[model samples]
Target: MADGCRRRIVLPREPHAELAAVPLVDLLGERLGFSRDTLAEIKLALVEACLNALEYGQGEVEVEVVAHADAPARLEITVTDHGAGFDVSIVPQPDLTAKLHASRKRGWGIELMRHLMDEVEVHSTPGLTRVRLVRKRKEA
Candidate 1:
């Protein structure tokens, strides 16, 4: 791994594909000097993104990582799936009060990612969905 490197991984639709994504994050995190807390957050967000891609997406899932050579070293990760997409705008806002009393308790992936990463962008169309997450290492 070099400075300002790019890594891409394509995973099949399997039960443990999400787990497979961990090493990529760990490698980049260690090489890029990500703090323990930041590395944990990135790993969590990546796993959630993979799970969403697997559950709602179709076929295979593709993940791309780019390490930026900047003051803080920005890391951008994109997860893409080939499933039929939906309107990201229509996703309901998560409400703790509502969720606590609801019969079914799920649908927190996007929100969790947003909270964990510095930036989270989701692009979707009729045939594809992509979740992009960006994080910057806090300078020590």
Candidate 2:
């Protein structure tokens, strides 16, 4: 691929549709010389972003991946959804103890994305939400 190459994928609002984008990223990451661990982290972060869009969005979901061809290439992924957005600041942190005992254990998507990606940003409004994730290629 050349410098500043971008890949765009649109998935229907269906369960597990987020998985469709994983392989593409995996392939791209491999070609870009990302390590196995880095690739795994990128894939996981991408999954969380896609899941958020699929579960919360009303219509189709759009994923755009940009590979910046620099000395250490990085991937910029943006997941956009058309749905009623919620304030990201209001989301409370997941309590480990409570989650352990609670029957329904979830709500760690944001944290996971933040931990896995170098940068994670959630931009949301009344009818649009965009999750941007970036992971830099680790120096081997």
Candidate 3:
């Protein structure tokens, strides 16, 4: 992959816009030869990020995917939004031991992203919030 192997999509903050990540992941899978499992992981993480943006963001959401040219090639995806972002540190961790029905359905997105991707980074401020997901390319 070359440095120019990057695509960016701007989406309206709507529920349907979350589906856009599906085709984007498909393109990445075709171009990078991602494994089925890897593609699924990427898709889930992307959807979660997009949903979060649509739910909390005030304006358009941006999704960027880049395939790096370095050895042991990697894919870097970023989901960003310009909105009144909150403090990530304050989000409570899910208590896995608790019954699913009783547990609060919050804070799982970030945790799921971290669990599925090789690297996950979240940055948030008053005007901008970014979630970065990275995964190594599977060897063919």
Candidate 4:
């Protein structure tokens, strides 16, 4: 690959689900030069993404991380699953300013991923679901 900062990892769908997502955050955070706190946030974002994949998707999960080798490094992480597709637009946006909040044990992943990353994209077609997350490298 010309843009040499790309890595792809395929994780088997297993009982210990966090196994798949943890290493990804470690690798991504390392590659992006993230600090401890920032790395934790990235891990949380991956957790959200992975949980959704494990819960709804079947079979192995695919994760991709793309970054730059040059100045002002930036990275994009994509997690994909072969599962039932859902409409991303249908997910309600959480209002942080509101006093009352909707509290349910479901549908928080998308929102969390969106809040943590600079950009979040969801794509689904029949049997595949892909979430693309972009994060910028902070100046050292």
Q: Give all candidates' CA lDDT scores.
A: 0.86, 0.85, 0.81, 0.74
Model 1: residues with Cα > 4 Å off, grouped in runs: 1-4
Task: Residues 2-119, candidate 4: write the lDDT tens digits.
Answer: 5446777786656766556566566656766877777777778877877787777877788777766455666677888988878888877766645155455455678888888878
The TM-scores, one per candidate, come to: 0.91, 0.91, 0.87, 0.79
Task: Compute the lDDT of residue 30 as modeled in candidate 4.
Answer: 79
Ranking 1 against 3 by TM-score, winner:
1
Stretches of model 3 off by over 4 angstroms after superposition: 1-4, 99-103
Which has the better lDDT: candidate 3, or candidate 4?
3
The reply for model 2, stretches above 4 Å from the true place, is: 1-4
Which residue window of length 10 is worst by lDDT in model 3? 97-106
lDDT for residue 70 in candidate 1, whole number 0-100: 70
* Ten-residue region with minimum lDDT total, candidate 4: 97-106
Prediction 1 global C-alpha lDDT: 0.86
Ranking by TM-score: 1, 2, 3, 4
Q: 2 or 3, which is superior by lDDT?
A: 2
Candidate 3, residue 23: Cα displacement in angstroms equals: 1.3
